[model samples]
Target: MNDKRASHGFRLTLAMLACVGAATLAGCNGGGDAHAQGRKGGEATAWGLPYFNMPDIVPPNVRQDAYTPLTDAQAGPPIDPIKGYRTEDLGGGVYMVGDGIYNTMFVVSDAGVILVDAPPSMGEKTLNAIQQVAPGSKIVALIYSHAHIDHIGFAAGVVKAFPGIPIYAHEETRKALAQANDPNRPVPTNTFNTLDVDFPVVVGNQKLVLRYPGPNHDPGNIGIYHPGQKVLMLVDVVYPGWMMWRRLGLATNIPGYFGLVKSMNARWDFDKLIAGHFQPGTKADVETQLEFMTDMHNALTEAISTIPYSDGRLNAADTKNSWAATRDWTDRLTNHCVNKVTPKWSTRLASFDVWIYEQCMALEQSIRIDGPSLR
Candidate 1:
């Protein structure tokens, strides 16, 4: 990795050059010119990468309405992001629980209410969200889509908030949590202890909530849908293009994503989608995500099966310019400027990422048959 301080790559260099190349060259001679330079400098401060492949890949987050990224003058794991919370009214005692950058939600009643994603930092915040949403109402159940830290980051929080609040997680989730607290924890808290709640599976006006796992983001990953309300909630399974959500281009599990889409499309009975992060979403986005997943899978499968590599390095002619190039050169470490930017997610997701990358390298080999493209 580059040893330069702050944002790495020439993108920042481009930004700085655009900021005052003219004024600096004009010399620091006069006050008026210097004042003009000041104005130019002020205009230079803007968020986001100045140069990315797609400007519209994800919607840009506005300052006032989105999670503001904190700058790190130092380097470590990618923990620059700190999640905060807010709520969006979704009518009928329902809401979109927003963590500034991502979104979570709840539906409440006197008996109990269902929650999407655990509150961050144990129950201090989850309990706080509960109190804010339906003060005094019991959190009858908690649902986790996957084991990503941001998704169930506060499972402990829920446990603390409501004590034995019945939490419903995918079967695999049960395993992850059961061993989450080991002293020699593997890959952080990838596993955890769920509330051991039983739930009913239903679709389309069916009151029964269901659990299904196909591709395995975290063994316990599944989607939550309310038949009557047509509310479908998923976490890492889908992320919206927004300021808070990171681009999954090179970070996601393409093959696992494909299986995930296939699984979701084959089953489930809802129309609205409340993804874990980015802008509020719809079922169409899920479908689109499916398509992308499939594309990635097909691309990777071909590469892996056909590409020829030796000594652990792919043959140059077979993978001239493709995802293989990136994977081959990916930094062995994802040192964040702060804490590990990624949360203590299920080992399943990690497994998926690994699978996807291996296949991606294969896909790179497949594309090599066509010769290198402008990477």
Candidate 2:
């Protein structure tokens, strides 16, 4: 018994020594000469892969002093610091109100004002804007561009201001609000289910046409257009001068998003576009966004087909770990796609450096799943 116990202890000691030796060689805790330390103190595990030059815009997981500055065109008219919002006239009775970040529209009619989207960011300021332009004009109706909290979270405030005012939304928006059951966003009083035809809401002299182009940014996100003013308002889809919010504005359906942007101009004949963010846009802005989307799609598709799954970058020991291997493959693929578009796009779109990697990753995954079938 003593001999057997001694032999077991000796083997355990040898095993521990082997582990310590391996760790020392690998620089302890999977780091060392085998890792690249970022400027911000984050370390990227070495994959023995060719170095991918990061875009001037900071990549994720790294702290930076500041982001790329916005171009002059990207910056819109300044907002009043005290009021915390800005209002722009869209001609005729239609006017746009925004905090320079979140925007909504209101149309003043002979009967009353028709308020479109009450983003919580602008909250009471939305009502104040309506009052500023058309004093004593009761907000007769409220329209939700979509069911997103950022866009319509302040609907209840509007309803409170004008008791029993009809709230209009697509059936999907109503359903979503009903599910949420939040007091901030009241369920629509009137809901439209038509997908093909335009749903027009005429209040006194003002008329706003609502059209649902299927699901893009979110389900039931409809286009609100004023034919007389030649203005179109669509929420959370186009970013005007900026690169889209991360993962294509956190789109639930990427293919649908691509389709909507591609066909937006052809479908709506509008001089000014109220895209629910930043400054109002023009047909030229839509065209620029479409070009960016197309480049992203084309670049991702090419990377998906040409970049090998293994690519000789991943460590041999990690081969059996499917998740690790997949992660490495995707990182390489995203980097390749980012590098392809950085030259032209980095200078063109605002925050192009900020969300480009995420955009590439999103598109690459979409092409793999919701694909044109990888060639």
Best prediction by TM-score: 2
- Maximum-lDDT candidate: 2
Candidate 2 local lDDT, residue 246: 93
Q: What is the total number of backbone clashes in candidate 2?
A: 0
* Tens digits of per-residue lDDT for model 2, 1-375: 698766655543443343334433433223333333221122222113223333333446544456679977788888899988898998899999999888989999999999999998889999988889988889999999999999998889999999999999999998999999999999999999988479999999889999999888899999999999999999889998989999989888888888888888999999999999999998898899888878877877777788778855467889999998888788777877787888888888888878898998888888888984223
Q: Write the per-residue lDDT of candidate 1 for residues 17-54, one digit (tens) a residue.
A: 44324423432222344344434655323332121111
Give the TM-score of each candidate.
0.53, 0.86
lDDT of each: 0.46, 0.81
lDDT of 2 at 250: 88
Quote the lDDT for 101 in model 2.
85
lDDT of 1 at 100: 48
Query: Candidate 1 — which residues are off by over 4 angstroms?
Result: 1-84, 119-123, 182-208, 242-256, 294-375
